[model samples]
Target: MIWLVSMYLSSMLFLVLGSVLNLGLSLLCLEKGLSWFIEWEIMSLNSSSIVMTLILDWMSFMFLGFVMFISSMVLFYSGSYMSGDMNVNRFMYLVLAFVLSMAFLIISPNMISILLGWDGLGLVSYVLVIYYQNEKSANAGMLTALSNRIGDVAILLAIAVFSGSGGWNFLFYVDNMPKSDSSWLVCFLIVLAAMTKSAQIPFSAWLPAAMAAPTPVSALVHSSTLVTAGVYLLIRFSPALESSNSRLMLLLLSSLTMFMAGLGANFEYDLKKIIALSTLSQLGVMMSILCLGYSQLAFFHLLAHALFKALLFMCAGSVIHSVKDYQDIRMMGGLVYHMPLTSMCMNLANLALCGTPFLAGFYSKDMILEVAFMSPINLVIFILYALATGLTVCYTMRLVYYTLSGSFNLGNLYSISDESSIMTSPMIFLSVGAIAGGASLSWLIFPCPYMICMSFMFKTLALSVSVIGGAIGYVLNMSAVSYELNSIKLYNETVFSGSMWFMPYLSTRGVSEKFLMLGELYQKVGDNGWSEYYGGQGLYFVLTKSSGYLQVLQDNSMKLYMLSFLLWVIVIFFSMI
Candidate 1:
């Protein structure tokens, strides 16, 4: 009890202090238009040097503030969510380590230093994902770790490519780097690293799988830490991408990720997976927008999404806890009647996610959509952006209908209530941010408003799609007992979308099946077959048989040995004669 109290109080204190300090520093940097680079020489050799670098700028400060704030809430909430678990302390420590890794990544503008934090985030997140000690958790952790490992390798390759520049700090080189083969290689590597970390398409299967972790961790991972690291890194590397053709490729991949996630979420029923898919969708939005040359908007959305998404996850945690650990939306209904506060917060976060007017998502999402519409993007990208925006609302509305509006669906004996203040307190705290974070971040991020001059139809297109999507989503999910599900009618399409377009299969079994089969063949022909006959086993068999024959001769009587010796001597004499 004492340890738990100490952990909670200490985390809250740090959260409060960190948030205030970072916010103040961010404002000061903004006011002065300042960026401070502090370098400490670790060692110097002949004609070369090694140093650690830290950069303090408005972006770093602001991102740090958001991260610390959300982490504080998550830790506090974990005190209750994981209270019964025996390894609660271990969980708290892992969460802190995760925050530390993110902080390192946030403050370092150098690729070498960033890799330190980058690898740390990946390693720590794998540990966190597997915290539950179950097969699902283990598999999810492996997927998460291996997927991020690709990014780690890309970063290492980028570091090698960056060696030619004589400095590991990319901030100085990104804008001024000359166009060369090495430069393009470095850019491609950075983009690959970012895409994998951000869980962009082909690499996105791990994001939802990661929900196997504790829900509090999900709030932190999806909202601010693990997933956002990629977008944040790319924000720092935006200059490199801006000049390269890689931006087009990133734009296409990210937009597809966005559309796929949104579609997948609409078919998803698991509470946490729905939210996870939403996070992936939002990440795609950030990456796509950044690729379109609006890193600030991407950063703004990242911050705002962190706020509401954290709140959303916390609310989901509350609901999941109250419902006896059931995560299926089908198992939950009329939750508002039991946990009004939680339902309200969940709905608020959902609304914010949908980019409802004047909310945090609206300020950033609305601007991003407006900018995307006005950009010289092709028609396919435009259609994807528009449809994805609608699907966002579609899933939110579907979730709301199933969880909040339906009749009580749990077994009659189950009691559901949001009586845990330890958990609810964090939700309320973040609800304030969810409600106002967008507008606040908008004022701070964009000193000048985005000048989006589009026709009336185009301007209102997002709003129209959202409204129609929400209505359809609600009406479709709200079914009579006699009515069949549309999903049943469109089974193939539903399966594809719900399955993330078979990406998880492709990522896990689909990709591994052939390799696993090859391994089996090797085991049959080499390790167990040919190698057994001619390798160590075969040598052992030959030596064992020779030893047995020698033992037989030694065990023979002395008379037999003498007679054999006489016969051998006579034969030798006859041959000599």
Candidate 2:
């Protein structure tokens, strides 16, 4: 037990040191335009050899530094969060393994090695998602795993098609690939794989469901590690997708995902699920920016978002723990009076999420929106981006109103206090990062600022939308008023938004029910009915009748034997004549 506790502390220290070292390395690389890579041949194939390769450029180093920092905090928090469990040591080990998998993903420059990390992330995350070993956890785990399996399959197919390059190392050919049909197909498949990992559009259902995992896992995996893997892939392969038609398709789908998730977040009430949906919305933002040919900006947002989001999840976990495991925000109110520090952290994270000026989200999100406005995109894309930006503020304000302010809504108000030092300490550390990460990363990522030509109206569009959304959120959740909106009485609209447009039901039950019904029909009509009768029963009847005739012929019954002998003799004589 002592060793386990020491392990968490020691690992946290190691990660902190590593992060600082990597940060220096990244700065050097950025200044010098230097990249380091190492490769070793592992196996010899027909013409191409399998090799393990590691890459260290500005992007890889910076992302690695961020991942390690967040992961270290998550592990530190988990020591307190999971201390009561008997499997706490095992949990720590798994978390370490998960971090290592993410590291593998970050440094690998080859497709095959990337897949190793990719699949490792998926497998470890599935286990983490179902760590509680309950029915809900199990079901959510399956949903998470199966959704990612689509990406795995897509990657396998991509490898098969890309084999024409005579090797699986995409970094070498990404810039030199021929403009052929196979190349286009490979690009399309790569986008498809990214969509799955990032939980974009049709693949979006699994993310919120995965909130069934423990809170520390949620903080690490959903916020920083697993979810960002897809965006990183897109950022790496942006060169290949620059001119492909798939870029347009990605832009359309990702923008829709952004709008849909933001709207859904407004209607969602669960504390963790709202955060999960917010993660989804942010992912959409990253993907959309990547589609718009701004990979550096996308990567910048990815890092900034990771900092605040991990902080956000940790804060949410703190609140949930304080309220006796209650996750519904409707039941939580007046928490600010009791848990001051936690509420402050939550508010800061929420404000950052809303892209408040000078905060972490402001740095990257503002840049992305500004770039979007200046890009040669159609009005539909522009409008969706604007609306989604507004909706982000709207939902975040709604969450704050329900969870922190207003009267105490819990049935019995027990004395609720802040968490122990073990938990709050990590939250404090992340809160600092969430506050300053954007500005720091902005300087590091973009040495030269982005120049945009737009009207004053376009310049303030994001802030205006945020203001309007904040107003709407306040009015909708005012505790002083007893007014009810008749619009909410409309079951269909409410159900659609509240249920994320029924995405979870459609992805899980809708598909599963249809397939299950098909299986039943097959059992009744084909297997039990036709197959049993025609194949089994028909064969039994034919064999039984033949056996009966043979038995009669051989039974030595005098009349039967004599009749058979006479018929045979007559047939033989006629043939001879």
Candidate 3:
């Protein structure tokens, strides 16, 4: 127990120190518009040498600082959350390994070195996801691991393609790739990899299912490190992608992911799953804006989203811990009266998520809308972006209504209260970040003016959506007819959205069932019939019959011995003649 406690304390201290160092480095890089790279040769090939490289720039340094900061807070929170578990030390080590993987990924600019970090993240995350050792955790871990493996395979393929460049350092030649169809194919593959990592569209099923992980893992992985890796990759490669033809496809798919996740969040009842879907929705937002060539805005939003989303998850964790693991929001209400600090934190995080004016989300999210309006995008993307933004507010408001308001529905409320200081301290710390991170990051990332020419209606469009969505969310939740109408008329749609548009089924059962049936058929026909008869059973019978004839010959009496000797003598006589 003392060892575990010391490990947690030391890990927290190391992260805090790292965060401070990186913050200073980030500020210096931003001031001078400078980047530093250090490389050490690992192997010398005939033409190209393999090397380990680290990159220090404003982007990497700032992101690293944020990751370390969040991770430190999460470690502190975990001390309380996992205190009773026998395997708390194991959990702490896994989280530290996770943070180390993220740090390696952030600092490495070379593809070869990046894969080290990339695969490490996938492996550690799978372990963390199944930490509970339950059937649900196992299944969710498999889905998460398999879903991310697609991205891992995509990265390996990309590395193979990039090998033709005579070096594994993508930062050097990514901008110089020939503008041909083959080059665009590479870009597409990179985007595909990014999509899987970021949970865009078809690859999105895993993000919500990963809620099976503990809330601290969710706060770290979903909010800042793992999911944002893809967006960060795209940001770094934005120069190359600008010339590729795949941006159109990326635009459409990312917009759809944003819309789908937002819609899904509204229908979700599980507290943690709801926040997970929100992370998915925000990831889509980052990806879509990155596709639109506003990577700086996307980066800004990514950092800001990380702050609030982590806070959101931690607040949700506090609520879950207090209620004895009840995660369904339908079972939670009047939490404001029982757990005021937690309720306050939850409300603040939800508001930040909704892009309420002056909050962290407002700074980046509003700018994204303005930029999207000003860009030369099609009407479809524009409408989807607008509707998705509205849906974000809608779901956040719905979450607030269900979890914080109304009557206390839990059968036992006596034991429910604000969590201990260890948990609430992290919540409070991140709550301040959720409130201020956007404005700070926005100013740092864009010191110059971000001028825009837009009409009054266009300027107010985002706020208008937020207000309308909030009103609808509240009215629907309060209405007596809503449940009856949902059951009678909109049952299918409700089920669809509630099930994340059936994406979990599609990715898991839909794919697994087909492969399983094929295996069964092969077992019955090939293994049991053809293979058994022709290979195993037939060979055994032939060998057995020959052995029996040999035995009969060997067991022969004097007559058989004389016959064999006579046959040998006849052969010798024929040869001599």
Top candidate (lDDT):
1
Candidate 3: 10-residue stretch with minimal lDDT: 480-489
The list of candidate 1 runs beyond 4 A from truth reads 44-46, 480-483, 516-577
> lDDT: which is higher, 1 or 3?
1
Per-candidate TM-score against the hidden true structure: 0.90, 0.89, 0.90
Task: Please provide, for model 2 over 1-577, each residue's C-alpha lDDT reduced to its tens digit, 9 standing for 90 to 100.
Answer: 8897898999899988888888889999999999998999999888888889999998898898888899889989988888888898888888988989999999998888888899999999999899999999999999999899999999989988877778887888778654655878888989999999999989999999999989999999767799999999988888888888899999999999999999998877799999999999999999999998899899999998998899999999988887889999988988999899988999999999999999999999998999889899999999999999989998888888888887789867577878488889988888898888898888888778767778999999999999999989877778423676654578688778777777888888888668779999999999899898899988999999999988887778989878879999999999999
Tens digit of per-residue lDDT, candidate 3, span 418-473: 74998999889999998888888878888887678899999999999989998988
Weakest 10 consecutive residues, lDDT, candidate 2?
A: 479-488
Residue 61: error of model 3 in Å?
0.8
Shift in Å, residue 389, candidate 3: 0.9
Which candidate achieves the best TM-score against the true structure?
A: 3
- Model 1: pairs clashing at backbone N, Cα or C within 3 Å: 360-438
Clashes of 2: 0
Local error of candidate 1 at residue 477 (angstroms): 1.0
